[model samples]
Target: MGNSSFFFFVFCFIFLLVLGTCDCLSDQEKDRIDQLPGQPSNVDFEQYSGYVTVNEEAGRALFYWLTESPANRDPKSRPLLLWLNGGPGCSSVAYGAAEEIGPLHINSDGRTLFSNPYSWNKLANLLFLESPAGVGYSYSNTTSDLYTFGDAKTAEDSYAFLVNWFERFPQYKHRDFYISGESYAGHYVPQLSQLIYERNKGVKNPVINFKGFMVGNAVTDDYNDYVGTFEYWWTHGLISDSTYKSLQKTCEGSSSEHPPVECIRALNTAEMEQGRIDPYSIYTRPCSYTTSLKRRGRYPWMRGAYDPCTENYSNQYFNLPEVQKAFHANITKLSYPWQTCSDIVGGYWTDSPLSMLPIYKELIAAGLRVWVFSGDTDSVVPLTATRYSIDALNLSTIANWYPWYDNGKVGGWSQIYDGLTFVTVTGAGHEVPLHRPRQAFILFRSFLENKAMERSSISI
Candidate 1:
């Protein structure tokens, strides 16, 4: 054979060999992360981030980051925990996954990642979703989808994502599953769990071996949230007595989601009185960029190591083309930049309920384990609000409230109700795990074990 012809034949043979080897693994297995941008070397656990198409005709897809349990190599025994973040338009990948509980956090420089020793993935296979098809890298081909989004549709799309996601990773088809989220997720988590519960009813041997759900500082009841928030502000000495009384009088029986003009005026007065402190965590320093707090010559975005002002770094990291390519995200070349919170989605959110207590009651009555936790320092969804909402359930207290300890110190407080458990992480704000990692990890481990938190002072 001629030399050129022989070389062409050899190339063809090698090409087929490479193609065959590449196609050997299942699509799901192929999705296993080889490496993430700026990931630390010598990492042991596998991580996957990509899109799961929930709707084909509409070309709608949701983004997810799945981190395998670092401590447990065996997938069969570990549970799968799905986490969502409540912004009505927030990216769970940005906040919940990258910033709070995920294995790695983007460094302040926005080009590197650091290990979070206290990540929840040590106990469970953590999945962080950027849901509703308009948040983060998730997108919809149908332009109208962005404009018309709400609680019901978000729940529906999320369930579809799960069903399809199971097909992709069948090894986890029957893995014990739990859902957890915070803030507006007070609406998202329970609503999705209700859907899962209802769907799993008639089917024998369901794909998702659903277990229970937990929410932190959730917005369960509008009235209670407002009352509790205003009461908390007053009790914490963040607002004046006159402003507090005005808030109480004007906000009574009012919707926090869409408050009346008088209620808005009262809230305005209270906010003005509270000054530049972060509303999410009263004691913690606010993100200088987001807040008006004065910092001499300190750029708002130039946060230091492990700073809680992570939004800026997260945004910069996700927007990097190399980072996007590493995760196989943003395949469609999204029109907008990556945002921690999506203005498009948040602006269009509709059909918010006045209360999720009824849904909680339904889930509790169905024998599903339910837990609600709060970061005591969070003024936005304070412990008082969660307490008031849980009181509306009127569940008989099985265990009296007591301090739960970790490492010979009081981690927080907890109380067990008949079918629900309530926990408070001391000194933590809206994002419990971010602020109090050890305590949050302890609470998470106890919740997964279905064991009571340690009440007596003892090292974890």
Candidate 2:
């Protein structure tokens, strides 16, 4: 063959080979997902985990894990559910994804994962985020970001993360999206949802496709929360009469985080009276895996999960080098290990509003779906607290309170209102899914469907 003809043939051959290689990989493969260190073999869903830069100037990024529903639903049709854990400093990747609502649970050995049959991913495309640049695998190059975090900054950063994240995937740009969280997320979810709702107005068509939001055992109104909490403690026989009276007298109008000296003393007395009985769950046994409580000069408290041992296991699993590498996390190799909650952020949280009810009202007025749920056994942010906060909204009742069932037994009680809904899981604690996975899943499905909780459903 002539030299020119041979050279052209070789160039064509190289071009075809490169094109074929690109065609072989699907979008899921193109996106980063190194197989989990020890994932279950039978898993059939696609999973992606990585960082999205929310602020390039400050080197702040948020880590996220997205799990497509196992039912093999089309990504276009399935709604997106973004879940945040409270604490204002907690790792949603660790607690929400690994321990509670994600598709898998860490094995007791902390080296393997097992299927979570009642995972929320079965209902939608679930996303778990470690937010605010200091929690879990998310971080900031600027050290001040760790200690100067609060509601406004967290909400803003999370919204920016969403905008950048949609760019990364692109497929889910206009997909129906919902935000949910618990505890301090009572503040996080509502504030972020409000921002999404407002931002949607300025643009012709929002890429976010923002829908509604839900919070479980959330901190809503400070006054109502304090009142309901003190009442719950008294009614549950957790505190003495004098201590309860003292709380009522001293903590009525003061900030719960920084009450007066008399209120602090009363709270201390209440703490002493209640002893080490896991204020979060009230009934579950505390994790015995670590002596860290002794090191901190504090009593260990029960974890919110049904299997209290899972916390320690998850902690161990997340800190593993293989696991971190698989998830593409901890790339900076910081001085400390990955913790479920960040001491830096939690200790230095600067601003918490006296109430999130105003934000909730704005969202509801915008015709957005708002649902608030509570685990009846959670003393920290009990059902009573949620009810009182909702009562402040004065929303009209659409449906009377009724029992919702699963497995032929009452799963929880739910009441529907014109612009909102309230639910209480029968035996759940602060973290509903971790404590009552089956029941939590039922509530989750009904919420997504925009219908009343079913009286009965096939149990997982």
Candidate 1 residue lDDT tens string, 222-330: 8888778778989999999999899888887976556778877887677678877776777877776343222211111111112256877898999999998888888
After superposition, the stretches of candidate 2 with alpha carbons farther than 4 Å from their true spots are 1-31, 202-204, 289-307, 455-460
lDDT of 2 at 397: 94
Task: Go through the candidates in order and give each one's C-alpha lDDT.
Answer: 0.84, 0.83
Deviation in Å, model 1, residue 293 alpha carbon: 11
lDDT of 1 at 73: 59
Q: Provide the global lDDT of candidate 2 against the true structure.
A: 0.83
Error of 2 at 62 (Å): 0.8
Lowest-sum lDDT 10-residue window in model 1: 296-305
